[model samples]
Target: MEVKIRNRSRVMQVLALAMFLSLVWAYAQLEWGVPHTVKRNVLQSRGSILASDGSVLARSVGGQRVYPQGVLAGQVVGMMGETDGLEGLEAAYNRSLQAGENLKLTIDPKTQAAAEAALAQGVKEHHGEYGSVVIIETLTGRVLAAASYPPFDPNNWRNYSAETRRNRPFLDTYEPGSTIKGLIVAAALNEGLTTPTTTYSTPMERYVGGRWGSTIHDAVPHPPTLTTKEILRYSSNVGMSHVVENFAADKERAYLSNYGFGQDVQIPVVATATGRLQRPSEWTDLVRVTSAFGQGMSSTTLQLAAAYNTLANDGLYVSPRLVEGTPAGERREVIRPESARTIRGLLQAVIAEGISNAAGLKGYALAGKTGTSQVAVNGKYSDSLFDSVFAGFFPADAPRVTIAVTVHGATTNYHGSMLAAPIYKKIAASVISNWAAAPQQLPKP
Candidate 1:
């Protein structure tokens, strides 16, 4: 009787164990969003972010990769879509920003903060339509801060249109305007077109063909017999027009290629445009002259940065980078060392003594160029709207970081000096003064 009872208990126990195992197996194989499969919800996921100094910029609230900076993060930090197509830095380095990996961006948050603060003020002052500011680490090609106005909050990316959410700094292209003149000066000198001492006489306009005409005038007009230094300072179209008309097209083309025009950025982000750099063979005389003054061509802001960065680096164009892993970009040799030096001085005048002279920082030596291109409308330059830009680097002797500041529409004035240069001054002052490295002496021109 006892043995029978024990056997019955053992049989019941075995049955219970079997049932439990079946239940566990069933739960393990439970379908998630699909029949008969187990799945986890993405709404339950999170991400992380850290600054260079080990500070948390943003992290998931529930301990995952999430938008912590809200809408303030620029195209470089990226966006989290409702359906999960990562935009900006989040998309570019999804694995790093989310997978609990440590990332050290080349940006200095302090500098970025200053830039943002200044730009915020600028937008308010100008009542501008759109704007962006980028500060770069010259040595590493790391984008410290890249932002455009009317920021689309990354948190509510779905609320904004794709166009507004798109990263304009690295994505959009425009006629770079007079900003390219600084670089043209550099290339001309490097290719042995003329020295800083070289000069040109100006006319109001020069005609290449009947309809294709190039004009030389300042924001208003200035001296006619302008030296290369003076041409850059005053931004003479005639002088630069002469440059394009006189220099070998192949050499100029090579310089522009080296300068980072007509090239796509390597930031691991999608939809980056390779700005148009029409070859010498394709050029008309008008195009050449206009291009000399940064018209008749288009370029992404990153491409513009690359051009200015080259001049800052003494004619060595290093690739502007934002991602980790293998760096496919390189330093292309564009100009002779002295030519680079001479142009650097003339550009220095832009910030130090030229048109943008008011953009200077008290103790630091800086050189840069201003661009105020007319916005295109119906395939013609718009009379009212303009893209104002200021591209430069500080401590002009040995530039460590280069920056590009732009405002699409300035209510007070359309020129870059009145708006862009002021912002550069504000950002540069804070960035250079706060750097940890001992303050270096200003480089001699």
Candidate 2:
């Protein structure tokens, strides 16, 4: 009987040892291929994404899909870590992307390459705090090239500095400066409160009721009487407020809504931000005038690009989408078709004769805006420091791509035209050069 009990005990001991071994193996299964960076439940095999030339842009080689595009696609291809910031396309399309199945992205590799090169050059020349470039397909919402300075290399992701590695295009919000005035222009025209021909009497600055007067001024003043188009071209803060204030708060709010403010875009990465647009009920007079000119307002770079895409699509405002697979190719119209024409015409004039002239592409007609705003330091707008931004599209008559750039903590004048425009032009030129054939005439705004 004792001998029989000993045998049973030995069998139980073996079972316990087997269970412990299984638990250890299960824990190992959660680790990534990289020994040091053990992410939880990280798939050993993600999938394949091929470039236009059939070369692999990314794949599930050593477990997780490796981003060959490197820093160029960083923000869009965000890292899945313990902390969340610019969790770009990779995190966004993770489940849908798996081994065996391939994700055919719409991004043109040639364009992406160009964007990276141009941004690098710009950074080298300016050597600002940091910079970012985003190239988007106007017809489809595919993000072609999203590059940032002090870029993050996915190979050694943990080594990248947190601020330098962040995908600034979609994650960070800044004062959009005079760039947001485009929406005010659209709102005024849409509400029938003003027309392209509407006239505004300009003073360099005007008064608001608060301790901070509502008075608005120009980045550089020129004329006293100007048309709506001229006001936009000049990016006149007072002029923008003149038209915006003429309408009720409801009217202005409607325009911003149509422009996609207070909304997040659907992109691959989960790292996205919806810029804070004070609800009409929450707006004050002090906020109103500046908001018209993109001050007292905040926006992510992607949100700004989406708005410009409307003009690129001839007033068709499709919700921005980013994913891989066979999804619907249809677009929903957000603005009247003809309204697009009026805005594009004015925007074009700005590129031709306004402050953002440096952003003009060589062979293509480009339409875009430039903005420079004081980033709040010590609770006040500091002249010494500014955020520079350039947002626009190529072939103004019909745009295929939209490129937006932001330079943070620039030491130069930091105007959008002078700083950011050149980067967009370089990227556009590079993309156009590599196309197999001339693109079809894009839909005009």
Give me the displacement of residue 388 in model 2, in angstroms.
0.6
Model 2 CA lDDT for position 261: 74
Q: For all the candidates, what are their Cα RMSDs to the real structure?
A: 5.8, 4.9
TM-score, each model? 0.84, 0.82
The regions of model 1 sitting more than 4 angstroms off are 1-47, 63-65, 82-85, 95-104, 209-218, 269-271, 324-328, 355-357, 436-445
- What is candidate 1's lDDT per residue for 324-372, written digit by digit as tens? 4536467677777677777777778766665434588655677888888
User: Candidate 2, residues 1-445: lDDT per residue as tens digits?
Assistant: 9999999999999999999999888777656334434432244445565554455655554545466666656555556443222355555555655333566665566776787778777766776788777777888777676667776776567887778667777778888887777766765676676788888898778776478565566877669988888888888887887877667766566666667777766554456788888878877766767778888778877778877787778777665555445453346566676777677777777776764347654345678887888899988989788888888887777688877788888786567767777887777667767653355533322
What pairs collide in candidate 2? 76-89, 78-88, 88-269, 89-268, 89-269, 206-215, 208-214, 341-445
For each candidate in the order shown, give its overall lDDT on alpha carbons.
0.71, 0.70
* TM match of model 2 to true structure: 0.82
How far does residue 82 in candidate 2 sit from its true spot (Å)?
A: 13
Show the lowest summed lDDT stretch of 10 residues, model 1: 32-41
